[model samples]
Structures are given as structure tokens and as C-alpha cells.
Target: MPDPLGPLSTGILAEAERRWDLLTAADPSLRRAVDLQRGLIGRSVQLFETIRTTGVRAWPFNLDVGRLRSKLERGVPLLRDESWTLPVGPLTDALLDFCRMLEVSGAGASAAHISQAIDSKRLDAGSLLNASLARADCDIRDGAIQLGLAPDLLWLTAELAVSPYAYFLQRSLAASLPPDVLSTWDRGDCPFCGSWPALAERLVDRRVLRCSLCAAAWPAHSGCIYCHEHGDAFSSAAIDRARPERLLETCGACGGYLKALVSDRPLDFPLAAVEDLATGDLDAAAAARGFRRPALRKLLSAQTPRPS
Candidate 1:
């Protein structure tokens, strides 16, 4: 499908326009999120393009497959950490440039300014990079802490740190892993990272869960990927303007909502960041029905946070 997320794609642009129409037709309470999605999509395009640029491969940390297998078999999360050091100077600079794009797009002007102060005087790259790392680390540790951080800045650092591993995994591991390797993990969370599905989809005979982080998709556990509650009692009905391939699936047990893309064909890999934005109306519809994404609850339970 020529990378369904490409912002320049006429198909995707048309899809974006349609989604916006759905959002506008719905209630007004979700305007901020829908508008935020509009901004987020552009930034996601910037990041994805950056990731796919020639010779921009991420680091290849050795994986302990035996351990991963054991954990998967036990329904335990694989211990994935973003500890490998990266070129902070370049990453920070790129992040700032992205924030500038955000400002130009009218997304997060104040947050961009807050992040821009690191290089306000156009100082040496080392100093600015160091400052950026410190700020990024602060949010990774404690999201509640207020240190004049922009949400965009936090997201940028997270992408810079995790996307490499995710990209590397998508390249070397995801496709090559044995199908039986996942026999034991049929729970609500990602067996690889324990992250919940930001978006999900049901194919002809089975469903898939796409991780909010890592952008990895795996077979789902039948119903309620958030709480694993089995039933047809979800608030995920398709409505006006919703395509047959997409809808919102909100679980009543956990008050968790997810965007599901239902299709008759095989499920495709999701452009997680862009898909999240693209499903803004599904998010609004789910929220309007009083269901949340469960990211906050999932965040509070785990000390470490990944993209939601």
C-alpha cells in the first residue's frame, strides 16, 4: 500500500479529510484532541521520514532470545530497556527542528519555546545536547514533574531513544521470530514490552494488537486486549462516517478504549504514531461514550513509560 501513513499520499490525505469530517460531525468536547491529532500527524511524518532516511539505522543491541522466549511462555514481559547511548547532540538538534515545525504548524508553540531555550544563544552543541538529555530524562523518570517541559519535547526524546530499537526489531526480529515463539502470550499487554495496544484490528479469523510503543503488532487474546474480558459487551459499534474497516472498541470492565481497524483481509503493520492520530475520531467517540485509553492507569502502574 506504499506505506499508508505517507502524508503526501492522496489516499491518506483523503482519509485525513474524511476523519476530520467525522470529528466535526461529532460532539464538540473532543475538538482539542482532534485538532491535536491534526498537528501530531505532521510531526509523525517528520519523524518517520527521519527514521527511514538512508543510512539512519538504529543500534542493534543483542537480544537474549532464550530469556524472551521464557518470558513469553510465562506471559511475562520481556525486559526491554532503552539504555544504549545515542548521539545526543544530533538527536537533540533534530528534536528542536521538529519542535520548530510544530510551532509553524500551530501545535505546541509554548512547549516548543520551552524546549528551544536549550540552544537559545546558539551555544556549543555539547552544552545544548546535555541540557536536552537532562530534560528528557526528567520526564522519562517522572511524568508528573513540572520542569517547564513540553509534551512534544518528551515525545521527541522518547522517539529518539525507543524508535531505534523498535526499528531494529522490526527489521531483524519481528518478521523472523518463530510463530510458536508467541504461544504463551495471549494476554492484554505486549509480551515484548508490556505496553498496551494503542490501536488494534481484527482480520478474517484473528485479531492483532499494535503496541503503542515499538510499533509491534501481535495476535490478540480474543476480546478486551486491555482487560482480557471476553464478551461482545464493548462500546465499539461503527457509526456514521466510520468505514467498515475502522471503529472504537471500549471495554466496560476496565473503562479502557482502543481504536480497532476491522478488515476482511490480513492485518497490515500500523504506523503507530500516525495511526494514533488518524483514529482521533475513534478516540473521541470512545471518550464520548465514557471510555478512556487506559494509558494513564498503565502508566501509573509501571515506573517506566513508553509512547501511548
Candidate 2:
């Protein structure tokens, strides 16, 4: 039995192709997302390869948040116009239209420039950045219902499968920053990015805080991941006795749960997303015991605007 997500890595690429086919067969609405996904995938590979060449020690992929901010500001107007075009393909057209809708919906200011740049500059840098932006935009449109912070949404979606290391790096940095730094920062298991945990693991023999962002593995005290609240009250239990090694970290006060994977398990496991899915029994057991995951809604309620 191979790991689903591991095999699904190939599936993601296959799915990418499958999506393209579906879009070609479907109507305008369905075509928009699939087109965006295809464009996003193409651009993602370029960005990931570029950043990976920089090595992990390169401060946050040497990505200047200041630069990202400036680009976004300039890109917003481009994102607004329904007629904007991008080189990523027809998806750029679809994305520009989507951004137009977001502006109309009050989700954020119109990013007409961001939309317009889809195929604007013929230069390599412009294409790469556009692809990065498109990747983030598509994910936001798809996952907006689950998590909603326009900027963070874009950042997380770009990192999801493309650059897991950069993803973790951005998240870790965001989490470590004082709230006074970024006004939009959210304090949650997702660190600062607001992306959901794909899975969690407990190195039984070693103490490591391996965050999904940046893939920066570190030493974290043994306790509940929800609030780092330690002690007997934060006990864990699981329904799969055969896999007693697998359990859920249950917090009584917050009613938040996280998957705890013992080090004995294979390292190849897609611990982030798959852990949660495989432990459906734990979720059921957690609920039976009056516990549940700390959804994005709950995390947002505690959001504090960064002080100047």
C-alpha cells in the first residue's frame, strides 16, 4: 500500500493535465479555474526552481516582502480590468476577470494592474512574477471559503505544492514577527500565513517542531500544538489501536486537535494533510469526547491588528 499523497504527487501533475482536459471540454465558468490552475502550475515550477537554487540558508528565499508589497500595489489596477491579459495563457484572462469580481465583491481593492500584467511584460522576470501571482490568486479563489485573507491567501497558495520550504519559511517568519509588524497577521496553527496544517508528527525519540512552512524543523517542547499548553489535561487518544503510534493532541480549553505522529513511522509520509485524513477515527473520537479542530473562524476572532 503506497502513501496516497506520495503517489498523488504524480497525481497532482496528472491532475493538472486532467484539469486542462476538463476545462477544454467545459463551459466558461469551469474553464476559468482550470485555465488558472494550468497557468499557475507552469509558473510555479519556474518560481520553485528559481528559489530552490538559492538554497535554504538564503533568508526567506531572498524574497523581499517590501518588493512583494510594491509589486502588489502596482499590480492591483492591472487585476481590475476584465480585459487584462497574461502570458500564462487564457487563464490570465480568466484571472483578471476573477480579480475584477473580487473588487466588486469588496474582498479587496481592485488589482487591475496585477490582472493586466498577465501577459504584459515579455521579459522573463515579469513572466515569473506573474506566474507566482497567478498561483496565489487561483488558490485564493478556490480556498477563499475556507480561509480568507487576500494577501496571506495568495502567499499560501503559491507555496502549497510549489516550494514547501519557502512556504514554511514565510509562515515561520510571519509567526515569529511581532503583531506590530504586519497588520494582517493571524495567530493560528498555520503560523502567520493562515494556511491549514497538512499534517503533524511527534518525533518520539527526538524533539522537533517541524512546521509545514519553510519545512524548518526545530525543537519544540512536548505539549499540545494548539496553544502549547502542556500537562495531563492535554492527553491524547486514538481509535486505531494497531496504529497506537498515531494519536490526536486534544486541548480541553480550546477544544483544538492536532495529529501526533510518532517518529517510528516512515519519514516519507505526507504528515500534514494525510495525517488528518487517515485519522478520521480520531476526529470521531475527539468529537465523542467534546473536542474539535480549531477552525479558521475561531482563530480569526482573536486576530489583533498590529500596533504601530
Candidate 3:
């Protein structure tokens, strides 16, 4: 089967590569990070294509438009719907491939250890993928400890692997919903996956939060997304006076900061990571100022339903 998202994915990869080249040319010091991201993006495309060709079914989310609208109004993430199911087989294959890609990319040796564990029957790819998808932090950490690998490293590998599936599901869910129904979602987290925005794109008149995991885009309010504080404590400043487009939005009330970049349009799936990486200096600057991004808010538990 032909990939449904082929053109969009191809465009994202091409644009990301072009941006990566420009970023590296501007600062040779970023070469290492850019190269690692290049490897991950290439592997992600391959995994996404593989899964797409295998033809996974759409998530069985509630089709009642009224109910979906009510849920959106209540600030409920769609992932909380009990009817949704995960396609474990394709996602598991993606996870295993992602582990190997991590090793090949020189991102870490922990993924190698993970692959070894799987080979030795010490780990199950489906279980690992499920844990990662559910954002079961403690489970992942405990498993990492048992495997003698860094918890963060293992979690990162698993999350990256499962992200393509998340993207696919989110896209399908969004497509199924009426445009007005989707527009009702105004929360800080992703309506589909419940993940927080990696950053926001500053369009001509409004800001659009970009999901870190599923790459979903939604309109955002003008204040601290975490606290909804629009008081004087919320302020924005350009990281470099020369490049006013790149900014750091800080909220003193929550002690949280979000990176914002002026863009002509919303970024596609996976490219949000590239933008996040391209603005590493903003992260450093925020850290220097004692501001930090908040941890992923747990909007839902591990509710992975069995595939029908």
C-alpha cells in the first residue's frame, strides 16, 4: 500500500535537512547534534513508512461528534477515551528498529544493551513499547535499572520509537473530527496524546502550540500555558537582539519558560524536534535564568486497550 502521509513526510524530511544544514553552517559547534538528529530523522521516516505500508487500522475513538465536543470542552484529552486501542505489532517493530538506530547513530550505548536484553529474552519489545506509549515513567525507570541501562536513555529510545505511531494515530483522529470540533480544544497539552508542547510557533497574529510527541498543532492563549497566568509575571524577550524572531517566553508565577519562534506556518510532524534542537541556546539561557520547562503532565494513565 502507498503511504498516506508520504508527501507530507517527504516534505518534512527535506525541510528539516535544509534547516539542519543552515543551522550547522551558522555554527559549526552544532554539527554533532545536527548529525545525530539527521540519523534519527532518517530512521524515523523509514519506520513510519514501514508501519504505514503495513496498513494499521485507525484508532476506534468515539465517533459521536457531540460526545467528542463535550470532551474537548471539558479539557479532556482524547487518549482518555476507553475505546481507543493501540496497534502493538507495528509499534513494537518500530521500537526495536529505533533501538538499533540509536546504536548506529552513536546517540548512546544503552539502546544496544536494550537490544541485547531483547535478544536474550530478558525484555519484550511489546511491553517496552506499551510502557513508553503510556508514559509509565516508574515502569520504564525500574526496567532500565533491572537492565543496568540509564533510565533516561532507555526511556528516550522507547519514546522516539513509538512516536511515529502516535503521529499516525493523531493525524487520523484529527482528520476524522470536524474542523469546528477540533477547534474547541484549547488546552496546553495535546488533545490527542496528552503530551505538552515542545514549543510554540508565533504566527502573524496568534501562537500555535506544537505537540512534542504527536506534533499536533493547536491555537494557544497569550499567557503561561502551564498556569494560564496572563499577569505581569508573564513576559517575552528575544534571545538575540539581532534575531528578534527567536524568543523566550518566561512566566515568573510558574517559574517556567517556553521557547517561541516566529514562523510563516506551523511545522509538520517530527520537525518540531528540529526546531526544539535548533533553539538549544534558548534552553541554556532559560536555565541560566532559573526558569525551566515543566515535566509532562499526566493527563491519563496506562489505558492501552487490546487491539480488536
Best by lDDT: 3
**Model 2 over residues 68-153: C-alpha lDDT tens digits?**
34433432211111121222332233344445544444434424433333335422222332334323334334333333224443
* TM-score of each candidate structure, all chains considered together: 0.66, 0.42, 0.89
Per-candidate total of colliding backbone pairs: 0, 32, 0
Clashing pairs in 3: none
From the highest TM-score down, the ranking of the candidates is: 3, 1, 2
**What are the per-residue Cα lDDT tens digits for candidate 3 across 1-308?**
34445435466678898999999999999998888888777777777777666656644666788987887787777655444445666666666777776787775577788777876767776777766666666778887787787788777877888788778767777777778876877677888777788899999988899988878888887799888889999998998999999999999999999999999977877789999999999999999999998876755444642211
**Which of candidates 2 and 3 reaches a greater lDDT?**
3
* C-alpha-based local distance difference test score of model 1: 0.55
lDDT of 1 by residue, 30-141 (tens): 5666675565555444455555563444434456668668756765555343244445444455556555655655555664654555456322333333323222333332
Q: In model 1, where is the ten-residue run with the lowest total lDDT?
A: 299-308
Per-candidate alpha-carbon RMSD to the true structure: 6.4, 13.5, 3.3
What ranking of all candidate models by lDDT puts the best one first? 3, 1, 2
